[model samples]
Target: MRSRQFGPRVSKDGVSFRLWAPAAKRVDLLLDRALPMQRRDDGWHAVDVPGLTAGSRYKFRIDNELEVPDPGSDFQPDDVTGPSEVIDHGAYAWRAKDWRGRPWQDAVFLESHVGTFTHEGTYRAMIDKLDHLVETGITALELMPLADFAGRRNWGYDGVLLYAPDSAYGRPDDLRALIDEAHLRGLMVFLDVVYNHFGPEGNYLGHYAPEFFTAAHTPWGSAIDYRVPQVRAFAIENALHWLADYRFDGLRFDAVNHIFGVRDEIPLLHELSAAVGDLATETGRHIHLVLENGDNRASMLDSAEDPPRGKFRAQWNDDYHHVWHVMLTGESAGYYGDYQDDPRGDLARALSSGFVYQGKRAAFWGGEPRGEPSGHLAPSAFVNFLQNHDQIGNRALGDRLESIAAPAAVAAALAVTLLAPTVPMLFMGEEWGSRRPFPFFCDFQGGLADAVRKGRRIEYEWAYSKYGDEVPDPLAVETFKSAVIDWEARNQSPGKERLALVRGLLAVRHKEIAPRLPGATFGEARAGADGLLTADWIMGDGTRLHLIANLSASELSPPRTRPAGKPIWGGALTDRLLPWSVLWSLGEV
Candidate 1:
């Protein structure tokens, strides 16, 4: 029931409209008719409409010429370019009113894009598959960005309206229903939010409030200037809006390294974490905050804190993914090149410590040292995954690991990832080995569409040369269609086997590993000369979890160190470790 400065505030006196437009000479509220708004100090324009209420559609006419949707509109029934619709947050009746969310250690995430999750691609449609996820042993459903974009389809990253949920999906209540249903089924829902920069199209802020953005630019667009109090409040309130208004279990911040802050000033990241932490404490909710920071700032994470205490619960461990990827696919281009030099060793480091590049120089990262030391953190501080949206979608062809890596090798990787003490995440269809390409697709039109096409072509020139005319067009409707996973595949031959494998692995993770993951400590891990990997960890209950893997194509001699306790996954310890073999065990420490 908290009021936010960024959006329309619904009260007993009706709807109060507010806009921050310092540069405009006059701002008018366009409802049934254009009405003058009082310009207050600090560039805020406000008007109290006594008769207006929720579901009222309105826009702001700037200087009597340009009318733009509210930047903080809760719902955009039309596309982002159309008029904004007022939404009363308290209107929807939540079914899971008592859902407080699950703990961080129990999290087994399945990252999904709601639009491509099913044929209908609506929030309500996604509810049908919730049972399948529960059966497959997924504890959490992590959705991609939902901020209103310019068109009918997008990856959801190029979101211009940070507050509004895109109309292409469904109404605001539909999304709430999805979350409500997820909680009812005991599944936590986390949203992937982009606060680094606004999308390229349908952004009208620069026309009126140019101070919202900095002169600098991110990889996507102009960086937001968070130094301004209003700009900072906008982002902070937006984060809370998702957590407080929608009741999401957690949030994954996308590309946070781009969100710049000064040393003297309290960084926006710290302030936002503090605000979220306060909410969690006040509400007595087990809210988790995860980051996708490329900087590998271990200082930002503190799993020890109950309410987070201005720190995040975990970070997406790209280092774990990169090393496994290099070992499986033999990729040596771009960032993958960093792990190619000693992939086995890198994997060992990732398995032992939280990060592989702990102040070490990375060849792919301009030969510069990156990441802080992360060995002291809890094992749950890193969210490990073999594949994610960026790892697959950013590829020139959007090829998944199962498509490129050997089947046995892929299975071995999954066995290690799923059973490890760290939290594990899966891309939507990975459990069923869905090979449908998740190519980068959008619904941009006109010059913006042309620019996107050209950029994709340029960025993937090598791919174009190799598969010319075969690469899916970024703006075509068919391209988006191709990304929709085949649900029937789940019941098919190999898909069933893969799904069973993941389910069994996760069953062990939840039963044996998750309960003892609280105070887990990292143990030593090493790679031998003959495709042999040995690692161990001490669980919170003082149980030792050990792993032994032989990743090469040929049989290798057993390591001097054998698995510790009862055989959890792979068959009994053999005299000779077979090719692509992986074994997990748990013993008393």
Candidate 2:
């Protein structure tokens, strides 16, 4: 029953319009013609128009100079640069009205980009594939950001209208149907939201309310001034709107490390979590929140408590991915350089603790101490993955690990990641080992388009020198099409084999590990110089989950003592582990 403060308020009586524009001297509500709005002392513009109902389109005129869509617009039918259409949030008749959500422990995430998920690339198109996910054992679908951006083919990160679900996909109802269908199938849908910074184009807040941003800049754009009370309310309300309006089961906050304040204060992240926790309590829904923070601040995660109240459920464990990548592909560019020296050892640490850094001095992080002690947190506090959008798209060729590394190695890595007690995620087509590339693509025009092209080339100068224009263009239609996963591959040769492997791993995870995840505690892990890895975790039911892996391409002799548990995966204990071999077992304590 909470009302949004920034957008049109619809009721049986009429619609009340409100805009927070302190910088603008005068504001006009644009329907058929401009109507002057009454300016409040609190720097808010208000106007009431009776009989203005849903399906009506409107915009705001600032000082009779520039007209802009509502920053809180429900739907941008004409994209981010056009007029906003009024939408009734309560109008949708959800079929799964009784559905609350699944527990965090049951989550096996499939992170996807809606635009490139299918050949049709629409919300309705995605629904047809929900059964595929269910059969593949993906209990949760984590979508990339859906906020309206300037172009038709963005990764959804350049969202300018925080409230509008990009019209390029489909209508608001269509998106609702996707969630509704997903819930009916017992799949929890979580949205990836960007609160750190707005996209470069189609953001009109600065024209009327310059105070919304600080002079400080993030890598994308100006840092939002969350210090302001109105600015703070805007973000919190946006989070609620998605959860309440569309009935999303949870949210994954993107790169929250960039959401910094000029002065030290209570973080907006905490406030947002508290608000969401209150909603979960009121609705009795098991809503979850995850963060993609580079800082690795273990203090923020608390998966120890059931239904995780008043804290984040988990964080994306980039450390786990980095070590695996270095060991597999031998690529040490960028952040990968940090793990190159002791990748096996780092992998051991990641298995034993939630973070590989854990307050250790990171050579890649400007030689500064990174991360906090996290061995005490529950094993589920980390979301482990082999690949995600950023790891793939940010590469020069956007090559998947299966494409660049040996298939056997990637499979071994998956065997370790998927069966572990920590929450596991998969990139869109990772289960089937689809070779389709997910190169970065956007639909910007003119100067902005050119800037994107040049920036990519500059960032990948080595690729530019060698490939020389063969590198995928971020603005090209072909680039977007190339990222569309080949669904047919799931039924083919090696794809079929890989699919079966993942399906079996997830089956075991849900059957054995999930029930015991509640009291799962971190156990010790050690990697020998001869490519032998020994790790274990104490499950909730007092069972010890054990793992032994030979990450190297050369076969290695086994440790003196065999794992105690009955074999869950891999064959019986052997004298030697073959190249890229892994073993998982659960033992009675």
Candidate 3:
């Protein structure tokens, strides 16, 4: 559905163009030559140039005037300002046709941002580190959004060209190569996509069809009008485009809670989820659909019997992170306020159900009722992570967990994230505990750049009053440079130690806990005096895994000595857990 039917369809010898501008009286194909298009039965304008070749740049002239990049452009090599290039979607020769993708349950995601993941910060350069990721036991690579924005560096939430890969990361084929390499090496790759709003700069969608957006405003920008047939088609087309054209296994939709003013039903989100299911069935590929919705709506992943056609594979479990963050850092700020009291129960709820809120009134929701009941959901439905791009990068200093919490505390959290019956995601360089600070950085030049800088300064003023001006300006090049990972650190002493910890934990998980994930999981969590949280998971197969974690800075009660239980990872834990520490034992009688 990508290039074969939509966008600029490049055949053996010519280029055919199509546009869906019901508002436009006339739209022409403008490139090496201007060609008038005929209005189709479906209200789409279409024209074909018999001898036009690939690599030529083109754009659509709307209403005999304003030229904008194609809404489904494959390659915007010259970025947003220039013409969109013609590229055949079937051009690349893929080497991993046999790569059927790993099972969804075996997914251990390593969330990476291409711009800061490596010094080169290109798709090709990212491919070079795939082996390191495989060694770290990451079965799937989850990239931050790669959609073309206005400039070189961004967190990628602000994307304008939904169909075009960011040119800063390299050409279209470069991205295809990275995916192909990952597949060949027994790793699956997925992309993060922003569907709620478009970027402020270089957005040309509204110029052609103003009806593409609505009066509703999201936190980032203008909300899309899903009720409009063309708008819904535009979004759904973009989703299938990434899968069909780019071979992306699936997508992580950013902030569906901001997609619309929610009332009763999420029609567009459900429709997109169903569409993904259809695509997977059609292609015979294992596709996954994940959401980062703040509202833990159970309907998002319900069985096919339910309304709204719930079929998503998983969602980002922020409840898990919130509980751990407050416990480990004693932070009662912002959203953390919701979990400050009796956090151990919340953690237990996060473990038992996939969501902590579960239709309860949350303090973070201004003491309002939020989050649907999700207690019936499977544990694997939650994507749990201790250090994701948001948890670290949203801070005043963009500090990782290592900076704010003790090593023992960090390890305790990692143990839960890795060993529990949940989908675990590791942020880039997390295994080696890289010190690179992933601050919010964007190259929104001129007025927008000044606005971002000023806005960041004002937003973090309270933090500055308390912690000083150590918060790097989001618009600076230095901030972007500072975030790039130093690949050499993985071999160093401390880095190697962290790496070994992760490797051993994952090894144990694959050997012991993985088999139990498919079976019934019975878990019990208890909060003791002196900042201690104890959790035990007994599987249907009679394999029991116990965790005693101390989130405090000082040591708690002593632990009992291990007789014959295998200790595969992390630090020691006897009767009492060490301060900020956890102990895991297998086959304990």
lDDT of each: 0.90, 0.90, 0.79
Could you tell me the TM-score of candidate 2?
Answer: 0.98
Residues 1-589, candidate 3, lDDT per residue (tens digit)?
2323447877886888888876788888887678888987666899879888889888888887788888778878878766888888787999997765655767889999998888889999999999988888888899999888888888888778888898999999999999999999988999999888998888877876788788989867788888876677777888888887788887898988888644546467777777777667667777788889888877676421211134677889999999988887888877888898878778877876678888778876778887887766666678899889988887888888887877767877887789887889999988998878888899888889898777766755544456566778788899999999878888997889999989888887777776666544546666655666666666546766776666667867753434245664555545655566766666643
Stretches off by above 4 angstroms in model 3 are: 1-6, 40-43, 261-263, 302-309, 457-469, 519-522, 538-544, 553-577, 585-589
Q: Which stretches of candidate 2 lie over 4 Å from their true place?
A: 305-309, 460-466
Per-residue CA lDDT of candidate 1, range 1-589, in tens?
2458988999878999999998998999998899899997789999999968899999999998999999999988988888899899998999899999999888999999988999999999999999999999999999999999988889999999999888888998999999999999999999999988999999999998999998888878898999888998898899999998899999999988887553244478888888898899889999999999888989889886778667899999999999999999987777887887789998999999999988998876678889999999998999999999888987878889999999999999999999999999999999999998898999998999999988877865644557777778889899899999999998997999999999999999999899999999999999976789999999999889989999888999888656567988887898988999998888988
Candidate 3 has what TM-score?
A: 0.92
User: For candidate 2, what is the lDDT?
Assistant: 0.90
Lowest lDDT 10-residue stretch of candidate 2: 260-269
**TM agreement with the true structure for every prediction:** 0.98, 0.98, 0.92
Error of 1 at 447 (Å): 1.1
On residues 115-203, what C-alpha lDDT tens digit does candidate 2 reach at each position?
88998899999999999999999999999999999988999989999999999999999999999999999999999999989998999
In candidate 1, which residue ranges exceed 4 Å CA deviation? Answer: 262-266, 460-465
Q: Give the distance in Å from residue 575's predicted Cα in candidate 1 to where it truly belongs.
A: 1.2
